[model samples]
Target: VITGARYPRLRRSGWICFGSWLAIAIWLAIVSPDGSSTKDARVKNCHVGGPEKYQRYVLGALLPEVDQFMLGFRLITSVDPLFTGEQASSLSNLTKTIYTDLESDPDFHALGSVMPGAYDELWARKFDHGHYFLYVPPGLDHKSPAPALVFLHGSGGNFKAYTWLLSRVADECGMVLISPSYGMGNWDSQGGVRAVEAALDDAGKDIPIDMNRIHLAGLSNGGLGVSRVAASDQGKRFRSLTFLSGVCDAAAIATDAFKKQWSGKPVLIITGTDDDRVPLNHVSSYASSMRDSGAGVEMSTYDGADHFLFFSHRDRCLEELSRWFTRQLAPALPSSKELKGQ
Candidate 1:
């Protein structure tokens, strides 16, 4: 747990602060000075900014970052449920799983959330006091173009949860990925959908995005959010919809507009058989609704996976998603004709 370089990085007070900032950066990534993994977004701006200008890369900070989990775990362990010794142990294991998944964060790493890497990750403001983070794929001499995947995370989750996966996955799939910090247990219908729409509109404005190839994916609670959004008038914007352990029955809480609007786009559903939290049965329930409504859908089931299958099997989950994106979202520069809308 020692984090000193034997000598200070600089003599100037400002630069010394900058060096300390680097330590903060490493610490924020959950890279233990003792032991941890480096499966996060590829980092180009490793050093902290200096005298010329000081800008903090606090994208994850505003939403879900390693630091939030670090603080949250301590809070979770001390909270109401884990009062007894046995319960504490179980809670400890659960927290450990969360840490493992975050350390191996798929979106940040897979999406290439860092500078001079493969892509650019940012945020777009929305009404209802909410905002959406953006992920734009890399460019060669500032002219490269690629497809995009807009993902939404479930309750008790934020953008950091997917940043690692998206960073790397974006590279492999040639897709830009974006997600917003909609808040835990609070799925703001209008806000969440608006954020996604804003991202798509922004991408379409420049760097070339295939409108026909646009797609939406969500997990757990977020699954419910996007599904509802897709079932609305705006849903037609995407070529397909993916529900991964989501609460597809958005009308119960969020909105019924989703039911009224039938993008009729292709659908892909994945559920973990052993998910104790949401259960594979829930997704099946949605499939029943879709089938009853004559909404075409395809489904896949994972064995021995938990409610957090996306985090538990990030590499595999993202690989499957990348393949799906490739089929659904044609690369922008490849052909405007390929875009169903363009």
Candidate 2:
């Protein structure tokens, strides 16, 4: 967890790095390399002065004009996550509110801030000596419940590393994405589990999250973490489980009682035949053990794919995974309302 001590250094370096990248990307959209432009050159000639001055125009009055120009054009397809029409407008307004809240709220500033983005994809905040990064789908209904996923990253991964793909998934699936940073620790450790729980609670407070649809997912060490968490009593709360490149020791965690409890719940295990780090045999064996114990488990395999196959087969994986997740979701129950402290 980044506290008051490390927070400043991270904020200074992290936000600035992200802000610098954002300013450059946005600036490139407003200006051409040859300095030949038809529209007013207010933003084209403006100099970037760190995060606070990122929006300053040649003339103060031109800022709104630049905003309009940006809103009007589709500068870059990858950087611009917002959709067209009313959805884009709603997301823009929500983004503004989130930014203002992060900047003006003393509690938020002292805790953490949003990860800067041309579209503001994610936010980073401290939790249990670790950090929890979150993304809410643009144009999410505040009054209606939306599904949420708690994603655990592998040993060498961080929140920023996976936010791009996860953000896209959240937008497509209408799910809230919560990724907890374990700071080099394995996710099954006591601290790791607590951090994940903290992340869920924090994300729930920020949006009208549907607890009934809450799902737990992980990759690599994260996949191992999912197995451990799902075997515990607390796992009963989740509607489903998705494992990517994950293998676990069935004897150590998946006891008879655990299998009995998970028998009715859905479990989707995705693996690659060519993943040497986690062999297909290990994952298949674990799945077999869970099935023998009466758990509802499904396994999917990709050919000619390695440990990093998800990166290569992203679209296919997301489409199938999204379908699996959608099928496992349960209708909002009365108890789900309590998850939001309503």
Candidate 3:
């Protein structure tokens, strides 16, 4: 019986295995160094710039995958010249500058070249329930009933990260910038809405704010969150809303109450056509839907821009936002009697 053996011979190619191992080694060399993970390398090479760079590096190191996906880079490659202790001190000093020093500094232009605003002062405080960051424009005081902009930070960002940009906006628009943190680096958790309410109220106590001109603003996750909040009964408190790189879920606002509450209220949605995180088509469709729902909707787009469009188009955004807020809220200048009453 010349029947072949039931077992078949197996073939293994050392060359193929060696090639695979070589490719893996190359990838590791490119993405990592000295046996450390890419994340560790990024942290070791972290660089802190102004608020934007601080937000990028710190958030990248802490939330690598999410930050990379949104910001479009791991923000790490070459080694950082800063030592561990130096980096720690640098981060601390930056935090103090953004969150503590600027707040307490009586000089109006405390940020100097970092942000524009002559005589504009920044302040931050942690209340019993939430954290509040306020930017008071030049000449603003208990008597100046300035328009208030309640800013919400995106995921992996805090009031400190946005203080430079939003404070500048507040200065340009002649408004008070009020940024509140929900204790954590998030705005979609329980008590989130209440926390915002509390922060705004607390800020009102410190400075005269035009309740009728109060507006909600945010970018990315903050944008979506403000949209959701503005559609609720709680949103009636604000005069209008501005969303950057954010989209409102049509399904969530399908109800008539949401539409009715937002009806006649203006909403400005700014997005980039090339945003992968929040696709352009999605933002367009949401704006259309909101318009149909009787909300005064305005959409602005930056061509060939992605999720981080704000970094490049910030000046344009500020201009558009100021115009939109002025047009929708119509916050007239308070007279001497009004200021005194306030």
Candidate 4:
């Protein structure tokens, strides 16, 4: 009797609840530690509370799924130091860039719908001790024996968004995409190398991966890991290596051991001219050393771009990568004598 009769105040004032919620929303929109106005206050709140704070805004957005996906990426980078020894706050500029792009680009709103099953597929499968994300392109099966691209992520926690983004390349090039995750993204360690190998082995068992056509690629700190893995005894398994906004170890690349392993293999270095974290000169020097050591080196540099170019310049980057894979898989030309019926 007390439960039903004593709640008269709650039942009589529905407007009170709505008014309280409205007040809370107004306070969140107008207040911040920086003491700025509405938009600036929200931006400052994002910086103070991390990208998770963006969730409140995302809930009110038109494309919640795409906003959520972008939020996941911002959260990951906000917690880890992607610039090797730098602090997580070093990604502030990148976060701002993402926010700007999302507001201005209408096409970006449709990113989540591009690959139908990408989001669910990435989260559904767990392999190699739950350290990898595997994606098999549509129309590919055990009968096709498609090539594989093993991608390594940079420092920060690994999330499905990366595999989702790279799935475009896999779809276009008709290749299987395997992304292996290492704790805090320490891919330069033996454990990291083992994780990659384990993922490849496990994926190979379930899919038709052309062992000889495997390619290795990494981003940011992952680029350093790529060098480590390519220099190991397992190095001979990869046909090509790609680095995106990554720095190569100067001492390691100069050594005879590393040169011997990657000598004839194709190396692609994609970087930004204004990348202060991983300077253009450093990457250029690494490319020169690899080329001098007899490795087939290709360098692609973008002007006025920074370390976060992978996200900002996504389309061009994917196109270049897909083209590179096609070049690698192209059949050799027939000899002139054979053409002449000799």
Best lDDT goes to which candidate?
4
Locate the minimum summed-lDDT window of 10 residues in model 4: 40-49
Query: TM-scores, in order shown?
Result: 0.62, 0.59, 0.60, 0.65
Write model 3 residue lDDT over 1-342, tens digit each, in one string.
423452232123566678897786566444421211132111111111111221221222233222232232223212333224433343344444444434343232222121101001122323123445566766555586778888876654443446555656676677888776443234555556776777788777767998878899887777756866776667888877788897564665566866878888888889988777789988888888888888888888888767656655667877787777667656468899999998
Q: Model 1 misses residue 58 by how many Å?
A: 10
Candidate 1's residue-wise lDDT over 1-342, tens digit each? 324763354345667788898877767555322111143323211111111111224434322334454455456656645234443444445455655665564433333222111012222222122334455545412254455677777765453446555666777776666565454524454456665565557545444665666678888887766766676667776777788877665353234444444435467887889776676766777776765554567787889876667766666777887787676655337466667665
Q: Evaluated with TM-score, which candidate comes out highest?
A: 4
Q: lDDT score, residue 264, model 4?
A: 80
Distance from true location, Cα of 232 in model 3, Å: 2.4
Q: At residue 33, what lDDT does model 3 achieve? A: 18
**Per-residue lDDT value at 317 in model 3:** 74
Steric collisions counted per model: 26, 2, 3, 0
Worst 10 residues of 2 by lDDT: 41-50
Ranking by lDDT: 4, 2, 3, 1
lDDT measured at residue 278 in model 4 versus the true structure, 0 to 100: 91
Instruction: Look at candidate 3 and give me any clashing residue pairs.
Output: 103-122, 103-123, 108-119
**Cα miss at 333, model 2 (Å)?**
15
RMSD of 2: 16.6
Which rank order by TM-score, best down to worst?
A: 4, 1, 3, 2
TM-score of 1: 0.62
In model 1, the worst 10-residue window by lDDT is 45-54
